[model samples]
Target: MERGNRIIYNQDGKIILQTGETTGDVSGHDTITELHYLDVEYGSIDYNKQHIESINPITKELVLKDIPVILTDEQKRLKALEEELSMLKEENKNRDSEIVNTAFEVVNMKLNNNI
Candidate 1:
């Protein structure tokens, strides 16, 4: 989907047409520098035929296709690592709290014994 400066090309890299917002006066208003869309502009794309595809890294282009989803190896590894790190952090916090409580209990026990 495209927005802002809505310009579509026909695979040949030629401008199909501009239709969203124009840089001109509208209803005797001031000249507009840009046109804003309330939501994503599909332009000439067929929503039914095409589905959301992975965006291109180099061109930042949104590709669409009606296909199944597959997670890459790197993506899976990253997810596993994130889960492991979260668990480790929770364990560390629990251990630290335990250590602090033990120290306090030892001090209280010694004072009570002397009395």
Candidate 2:
């Protein structure tokens, strides 16, 4: 993944943090599953150990603003392709080894018949 991202904090940087092209791409505030979507996609996602909050002006209370955190369509598509290629490579290796083992078995059987 690229080093730089385009997300900005919402709610005076309070309610959510968003990036990419789509809405709520890197959501902050609450987390789900032992991980969140933001964790899966971004290199760094900062949150307080005790409490997580959004960014905003220091002096005043902030209201909710809608910002998007997104992974571009192209990026998502490329990631799928990479996964497919990796699986294909693993399958190819298995097939290649099968061929080699079969060939070795055939050679050994032929030698036994000759003996």
Best by lDDT: 1
TM-score of 2: 0.29
lDDT for each of the candidates? 0.69, 0.57
- Whole-model alpha-carbon lDDT for candidate 1: 0.69
TM-score of 1: 0.29
| Candidate 1 ranges beyond 4 A from true positions | 1-70, 99-115
Quality of model 2 by C-alpha lDDT:
0.57
